[model samples]
Target: MRTVQYELMRPGELLAEKERFSVAYLPVGPLEWHGPHMPFGTDPLDAQAVARGVAQKIGGVVFPTLYCGTERARTPQELQCMGFEEEDLYVVGMDVPANPVKSCYFPEEAFGMILREYLLQIVEQGFRLVVIVNGHGASGQLATGERLAREFTHNTPATVLFTRAMQKLEEGDQRLGHANISETAMQMYISGDSVDLSQLPPREVPLKTCDWGIADALEFQGLGNAAHTVEQDPRDATAQLGRRYVENGVQRISDQVLAAYAELEPRQGTKA
Candidate 1:
């Protein structure tokens, strides 16, 4: 069977794929707490599934999932929004101060260097249209992607696109928060055993940021209120819902990648 997964493909297969389609998908996220019910690698897991779904629709290689991302520390105002008095452990990214296991978070500058290395490597591999499947929703992460997208697209022959997963894919979809129903549903869609709603608190119980998975965290003062209760039920999450998100994400990304590929296909290429 054919595969779009980069790590699984042989060199010959990879080269053939590059000639056929000049697109590469990089599913990026960090290993952070997502709550009790969901896996810790929820972000990248969701990203990989969606990226592969899109690749199959169009044509591309799904790079190995990047489980490292950057986040800025919470400012006084941001901390205040989260109902925190100090920044002792209220740093940004989903690794709440409550969780015992810390996440793999890189400094912004360090992450930028690492990301640039990957981007350059992918481009040098002959992929003219590279899609950065952003799984983590950190402010610093977004800024880095935006900045690099412009730099690489303008300076190089490639066009880099940094897009968040499940953003505006569905007609009335709410913002996909950290380990929220959407993320949980997407994870459920990928693997049933990957999520266990039973592991979570009772439906009526409000899950705090430290519970591990913030399946239903709602903003009260700032964003992702630490004092907020879960607004949705993780039990309501189903593989079917996950499938819808993945399918919708695939379609939206497929459209963009296909368009870019078409425009760049006319460029001079020695192979096929």
Candidate 2:
């Protein structure tokens, strides 16, 4: 059967599924550099790939990802390149362009407003459940996404699910951090054609010993550090490992969504 994708589904089919449970997925990623080997849009693309698989198993509509979020450029030159034409030099966070640092763009107030409107619009269109599936380094945004989800759910008759921390799956001794073996492997397994394994750089430092020096030393007065150049060597990454990560990620998210869906029922006044 053809899986439901908002971009590909016909209007009539979408209307037919109005009463049935539908999920709207939003994948958030930054425009900043990942590494020479991986495309700059790696986070968002990887996120969408995983999200599509998860949504397919859950049987819901997968919406296009929202590429803008909290991001920072790795260097002043990069930031200049990204924010070059923009009028506001200190636009902040993901809005600042090629995010060089782990800084989050979109302030709390702005995020709340934007998310609230998005959820309300989805609910108005009859999708009761919404999930913001993000694959970024910053976990704080998950809290923001969850808060918006909870607020939307409480204020309206809709149900929202945010896949925050991966639970129920063992760590499996795989590197789970940014642009590490796991993510690179998943990209190779999922988006192999788009992924240029030769571009991936060799990991100079061990994961356990690496520090958040760049983010800490930013000091709000000087240029931030560029850590995007670092990545797990693709030589050590395998398609098999990528497949395992994708499978585990999909299973974990599906389990959570199914559990959440069972507990949810639309508000009495609103239609499900």
Candidate 3:
């Protein structure tokens, strides 16, 4: 009912709220490039908004979002998407940044460990339900959260759930993309002042899908001709569409959180 952000609440407030409903929402995303119109923090920001909405609906506490997740290694095709010729690029360790693409990535193992520790801390704080909502579509990042949730819940009283806001939408309602229609619209709704649709590239960038398995390997090997940087077109995105996305996403996520909380109610009663 009050501020759902864990960091903003007083110790007494948190303790009282924990007794009322012991659910913690953790939002995770990457700081990757989201075209010129949207800010680089779009993923986590959108995720945090969704988490906040869910927390407000279910009386849960939302944690500070984790922005370090797996990102695609830049390849020749990716270079082209940013308007750089293949010959203009040079490999710099695991990155090939000819364009300004800001993404914070943690190795798969390290991310899993970080998630595990975060969950442990939340459980230690007496929370019985943990909801992990990710905004990034990278398989490695998504998998890390889901895997950690399964492993942690197997050995603890906490019931951890790993899911993405987009995953809750119907297939027809979903249009998951990188800085494209869905994300652009959602960001516009969440932080309208920050969004500048005029900055979108002049031409529409064609969408290219990749096999996650080979996509990462090829990028690492510098052999993929796929555009891993940008996907879909955001020229038609509007704040109204974004509001629709937020409304639908919040309802779906809140419903799931409520269901999880109901299931954990019995265990919560046993805790004290």
Candidate 4:
């Protein structure tokens, strides 16, 4: 029951837990707009909570959540369709728009390189296993972690496990959303005061559809939307549902982490 957070632990505490420090959890997400009801830090916050739970159940330390991530691509045509001018879209980390908005973005290549360096450092720190848990569901961000895991395992002794929390759910049970029922519910459960149901818009906004590519296909099916960011209605969101999602997520991630750590037993012994 030692401190699960790496940044909060004292040097001696870390040493005391060194034997259990074979794994490190890195929760990565973006600081993007959720909605009026939810905070913009929802992604990283959820990621950190899930990571901490996994670390507590297994033996590991959860690093401080990484708030920078790849942004949703906003092509010129898409922007125009959304009725957003170029200037209307504020740069990452900028506090403009004065509304519910903010996205700390980095190019995919840069983000991938950053993750690679992070994994290298984690390996150097003597962790035989690392889990990169991304709360954001962007394809680019997910791919970045997967690519880094593959490349890092090939080049280093560390076994990197990468996944998006929402992706772990079964197809019919998946409740992925921006600030919708699932996300809002999870946030409400994790941080009770962070979400204000009363602040949700009075009515739902329609989302635009696209004609080309898989991204567009998903978008057309209400998977991706700009204005009505919520995938499902938030009216039914409750703290109870959120607890279910959080617990399910923690169980899924913990199982994966344990499986991956077991796979690294030989490598871990080699390092020892």
Cα lDDT of all candidates, in order?
0.76, 0.58, 0.70, 0.69
| Ranking 2 against 3 by lDDT, winner | 3
Candidate 4 per-residue lDDT over residues 1-272, each given as its tens digit: 65889899997777666675578889998777665667778888888888888878877888888887886465555444433455445322222244444456788888877777777777888777888888887667888888888877776778788866654356676455556567878888999898887764455543221210112223324345664233456656899988878778889988888788778766654532
Clash count per candidate: 5, 13, 0, 0
Ranking of models by TM-score: 1, 4, 3, 2
Error (Å) of candidate 4 at residue 127 is 0.3
Candidate 3 residue lDDT tens string, 222-255: 4434465333356677889888878787888888
Error of 2 at 102 (Å): 12
Worst 10 residues of 2 by lDDT: 208-217
Which candidate model has the greater lDDT, 1 or 4? 1
Give the per-residue lDDT digits (tens) of candidate 1, residues 1-100.
Answer: 4799999999999999988887899999888777777887888888888898888877889999888888887676655555456546556665666676
1 or 4, greater by TM-score: 1
Question: Whole-model lDDT, candidate 1?
Answer: 0.76
Any runs in candidate 3 off by more than 4 Å, and if so which?
Answer: 72-98, 203-232, 266-272
TM-score of every model versus the real structure: 0.88, 0.71, 0.79, 0.80
Give the winner by lDDT: 1 or 2: 1
Cα lDDT of model 2 by residue, 1-272, tens digit: 66567888898777665556566776666554444445556667766876888877876777777665553333454434322433435544333333344433555456556666766777777676777777665544566777887777777667777773222237445255445456667778877876665543345642210221112112232232233322334446687988887777778878777877776663535632
Cand. 3 TM to true fold: 0.79
